[model samples]
Target: MPSLDPEEGDAIRQALGLDRAARPYRNHYPAPGDDPVAGRLVERGLMERGAATPAGLVLFQVTEAGARQVGARLPEAEAGR
Candidate 1:
């Protein structure tokens, strides 16, 4: 797994979980105070920022490397499900 900062990664994880199941992107937590995991991922080119729309949303997607990183890090419980 990539060395993501837990706090930041957790935020991203939370954001990912909020999607409606059909959107290409999801919104982040309402605030962008600071998240080390998110910062490191973005800094390392694993995550990219997208525009914040008038609807109050920000978008993000996993890079190819990021997809691999997350895939590799899946917990056994989640993988089985």
Candidate 2:
């Protein structure tokens, strides 16, 4: 995978809500036109695209690897492993 630059890292953090608190597992639904970095994130395997909304907007969720990249704690089960 490609290394994350400052912009990409910041984007991942924002998507995971790490910018606010430490919400590592929260899902983010960016505005339809606000997904330039999102595609790159998905390509990097840090985030995955979820189901589409009624209006056709896609849901984006952080993966375990993505959470770790941002220094966010994994769930108990995954963490224990």
Candidate 3:
């Protein structure tokens, strides 16, 4: 988690929608070039670039491991395994 401290786990979690997805969820990053966290998440295999959305933008869905990290579970359809 270089450049991202342990205290910032919340930020990463929020970015992954683990915190707000209690009501709903979607796959994405905040913006382009916001790669630091994205890179880290990718490195950990906690997130991945999935198919393009209707607008052709890449979707970043959280992996099973990522959902576990936030004490949530990815639906069977969304689970990587």
Among these predictions, the greatest TM-score belongs to: 2
| Best model per lDDT | 2
True-vs-predicted CA distance for residue 63, candidate 2, Å: 0.7
The digit string of per-residue lDDT tens for model 1 on 44-79 reads 876666556565655554454553444423223322
How much lDDT does candidate 1 score? 0.48
Candidate 2: residue 71 Cα off by (Å): 1.1
Model 3 Cα lDDT, one tens digit per residue, 4-76 = 3463355346645656666215444543334566656767777775555565555566766666676666655
Residue-wise lDDT of candidate 2 within 1-81, one digit each (tens)? 567778778866876667777555454645453587777778888877777778877777667777678677554543333
| Candidate 2 colliding pairs | none
Rank the models by TM-score, top first.
2, 3, 1
| Collision pairs in model 1 | none
Off by over 4 Å in 2: 23-25, 29-34, 74-81
Residue pairs with backbone atoms closer than 3 Å in model 3 (clashes): none
**Candidate numbers, best lDDT first, in rank order:** 2, 3, 1
| Residue 8, candidate 3: C-alpha displacement in angstroms | 7.0
Q: Report, for every candidate in turn, its global Cα lDDT versus the true structure.
A: 0.48, 0.68, 0.56
lDDT for model 2, please. Answer: 0.68
